[model samples]
Target chain A: MEKNQILSVAISGLLALGLAGTANAADNKPEMEKCFGIAKAGMNDCSGSKSSHSCAGQASKNNDPMDFVAVPKGTCNKIANGSLTDGGGVVKKAM
Target chain B: MPASKYTFPCVAGIGLRAPHYREVLETLPELGWVEVHSENFFGGGAPLHTLRKVREHYPVSLHGVGMGLASATPLDEKHLSDLSQLCNDIQPVAVSEHLCWNAATGFVINDLLPFPYTREALDHVTRRVTQVQEKLKRQLLVENLSSYISFSQSEMTEGDFLAELTQRSGCGILFDVENLYVNVRNLGVDAEAFIKTIPADAVKEYHLAGFSERDGCLVDTHNHPVYNEVWDLYEHVLKHLGPRPTLIEWDTDIPALPELLNEAAKAQLIIEQCHD
Candidate 1:
């Protein structure tokens, strides 16, 4: 086939993929919280405010104030020192 | 024609990172070819889509950093399979991995930690390279690593190990010139001997990058432009090994596309001079 024909196929494929992605997003999306000040060393979700973990799971100590542990939306506050904010404020985003 | 028909052009290219993807695709600059960290595109959404677009204009080389070929632990089958899938998708001009290890035992180290140049390590790495080659059904270019330390336990020099590795595994060499420079400066590696020991014919590519110095050790940080000393060293390498597809690798603090192309131009000029 010619160039335009090949491109049409690719365009159609991308459209279908995009549509499927939209449907999946409408169906389900995970809601987790970046609960700061609760992650044990080496178990943080990602690099912290101070970058305790450059690579994932490279944190050096337990409950590092800078590190975070991503938890369920409503579950962060119940755990001690677990703040939804980077450095916790009273105004929290919707769970 | 299929993209698979493209081969890495013997000129200068840059390490295509995420930051400049938009600009590169928009401008479609005249790059000799582009190399990318294989792990970065494994996710296969926007990254892979952009790469497909990039492949239309340039020959792409899939350079892997996480294979951990010399790692003592068993090979990561999943990683190999992902790479094979990527090769199938992209039909890259060349597929290469570093001659270093990242995983050991239960932990996965993010950095390309060095290993001893022992006979045992060679045998292990050779077997792993053969396995990767078989799986990919293509020749894999194993890059020499930049190390700050050396092992005194046993065995030969790195160049010797790489020479034997190529002979045994039927693989090619991605000689990172700056890595050798770092070893020479930091660990007192013999530069002339290294230049001589690597079978020139086995060398399929060359890498030039700038390094950072902390205290006294030279770190293989590909952020800055190719240093004057490294350019001098590369000139020496070209006199011996001749020229191949050379790359300008800048991972951090990536400048604009023109700046990168300017760096590539320097390599292109040197490559042209060497050709003359």
Candidate 2:
């Protein structure tokens, strides 16, 4: 085989490997869903049920049952004392 | 890597929230550009879909509210990765984050919180800013924060901190006029002094939002329209720093699409008057 042909084959192999690695990384990401009443004070992803506040980081109280955190979809209900519905569970005030 | 090729005209724009996405896209409003909080679209779904459609019509600036650049904790790799992916997908005209710490130790605060502006904090922020810029391959604009409280620790002013951060991190300034005004009223910060200290050339964008007062302290709430006082201050900014891409941000109780556009028009008029 020609030297150039060998070099081309090696480069193609590395490119294939890099592409596969990226695909694996993308596949590894867990499915995430917003879990309310899980976010601590100042930790909510965005505004909760409160109509007074318009955007993120406006939780007036710690773990206000309205606030939410992005957790693995199925895992939200599984987390100890975690509630998926806003204001459904006991409010865990921020420590 | 050379400061993302994306750029916006030196005009006024609006922060496109979820509620107005459909209207803005359908109507194709006449405006300079539009911005959205980066975190809102971090995940793929309707938000990203709407943003993609909006991008076809106007320039989009990805303004971040959760990067927490100065957080004492290490930079959030996952958050940075998500942002990088979004930037690649959207190819935003400009990207920005606040110069505040949202998380500390183990707790992550959703709001932009103030921190002591000491040399130690400056070093920490500079490193994080550089990391973000490298990841996005663009000049990330760092915005000033509106604080409800002040730290008594030894340090410099927020303006001085931002100036030095820009110098050290090769980042640009977002120049939130409303935030500066909030600080001026709530914290007694000198807005004019701040304008002088910052390098005007590095100010890539300006943010104009409304504030609400609580217990004699002004809160950076975007529900109301830009007040006359903030507009007056904006004129001073345009005069001193020159006109840049300005945005009207109304997050709380966002009114109709026309109202938002009207606010942008007001900013546009001011921007035009400055040039004339």
Candidate 3:
């Protein structure tokens, strides 16, 4: 009886280890989120902005600040015309 | 019969995030090329308009993240058609997608999930790859994916499967060196041996990105800069496999244009030195 119990416990432990190993494999999500947060902070810091900014509208080449529907009053033209705030290094259009 | 015209310049390119669209076009950062996710710009209006403008300035490449080609469920024809349309509109230098599957019939996980890699799976993937290539009318660059689990059902190694796919479908391989490194640290894969198995000529592009350590394994999280070891392996591959069009990918915590370009420039310099 004692021997059987010991064998069962050992088997269970091995199974647990295998399951854990599989779960902790190559997941890119958590680190990717962390990197994105850091990049956002880096962009804000580099461009001297206090609040978050969206690149989808302002980064457009047309530079018609009016073309973007939700341009923040202070931030849009405040960023130079050809000087874009996004990471792709595109220059904004002139005001 | 210009082979190089179908190819990209042997220079550094940036992942064209929406943030720097105007700045990039107006100033024309001396970049070799630019790449954007096809799904992100699938919808018209602003995204398409911006991509069109950027396309004018730089040689763009379309990279797809959510094809789920090896899924147990059927292929997403809508997604494939969208990609085909984008390819036609953009006329990108290259088009690529991840190797792992994501959509199961009932449930669709947005993450790139690995499978058993059995003969059955290979047959499924090969068929899907052929379908995608035929639909697009261009050779698709299939990237190797990073995985967290290994199924006992696997009959072949990932390298062998990829080699077979290349041979059967006439597809180009986008060897993500970072992914191979992560697999080695996490799953005891022999990176050098894996490299040896692949047909060097079939490999048209190389991907370098950063990964973070998880428990005892490493995950291919594209949030950080290219690590030293990955760079070293890339150098080795370039020397042995020969210089291919290399991309510096940072999907998460993406830095500023200059910072990202700097990373790309580092890769570009290494790539240039390898050929010399």
Candidate 4:
């Protein structure tokens, strides 16, 4: 079927159901840990309070310098090279 | 999302952010309403799915951060179309955008920049807002912007600009009280003059957010809780314009959901006081 037809059918089906399915099963998110030195540009959580750019979004580094990543709790130390801290700005980027 | 017949209630709500999405969806706390940035759920991805689920529970408001309504360049058609699609899927109770510009002839500024409130700008913004409303098929709420710089070439004040924008475009106003406070501190804009100039009836909603101070400049960072002085100003605004659908927005460095609700409770108390 064409795109518009498919959309119409889906919307019609949804409206016909008169309140779609019940809200998805509760998000039961896992206990995640922040693994330093892995996050790509514009994708990681806050760098840290000490950093100038402390809100959401990863820092854009002029170099390949790692920024940190969030993995499930208790797995950061196991990564090839993941620490809990910024290692004295070695991984942090210039704001 | 159910085809909502409900209008925005005259109560306080929270700007729903990503960090608390699961908690909000699962627990469905005692929130008056929820306002989400319209750009986040544009392409029917996980965000849109989450928003659809949210729409089932709350009267969501589609607040656009990237509309660039008053930009000197032509309005971004793709952005407008994406917003219109989101509206169709969510059917928000109210839709709002900032009264500022982001795009220019060559490059686009990511932040909301204040413009000179000139007659030419008035006509330009009016036409663009009209275009947006025609596409969305509903009234758009244009929120006043927080400014760091002011144009010396401006003919009138920001309040006058907003008042004129509403009249010329047939749009409602989403008066962000915190933005007004920032302007008053940074630019010496008279709060009383602003409060008196804008038509009270044109105001459809009120945005209450927190700001951070950097080098003596009050920035609308939305990372802190509503401050005491801003709350005082909100009281003044409510007394003048009466209570509207107020929202507590904490965009950056967002705290826990309870913290947000606590702020909303404060606004709710003030709204009740003004109503009484």
Please give, for residues B27-46, the per-residue lDDT of candidate 3 as tens digits: 77777788887887785765
Q: Of the candidates numbered 1 and 4, which has the greater DockQ value?
A: 4
lDDT of 2 by residue, B43-161 (tens): 77656766787787788898888889989788999999999999999999999999988898989877788899999999899999999999999899999888888899948999999
For candidate 3, the lDDT comes to 0.76
Interface RMSD of each candidate, angstroms, one decimal = 10.5, 8.4, 11.8, 8.9
Q: Give the clash count for model 2.
A: 2
**How much is B105 displaced in model 1, in angstroms?**
1.2
Give the alpha carbon lDDT tens digit for every residue of B142-257 in model 1. Answer: 99988878888748999999999999999999999999999999999999999999999999999988778876878887768999999999989999999999999877555777
DockQ of 3: 0.01
Assess each model's interface with DockQ, reporting 2 decimals per model: 0.05, 0.06, 0.01, 0.06
Better of 3 and 4 by DockQ: 4
- Per-residue lDDT of model 4, residues B40-107, tens digit only: 77785456777877888899998888888889898899999999999988889999988888888998
Question: Candidate 1 at A55: error in angstroms?
Answer: 13
Candidates in order have lDDT scores of 0.81, 0.81, 0.76, 0.81
User: How many residue pairs clash per model?
Assistant: 0, 2, 16, 3
Of the candidates numbered 2 and 4, which has the greater TM-score value? 4
Error of 4 at B5 (Å): 6.1
Report iRMS (Å) of candidate 3. 11.8
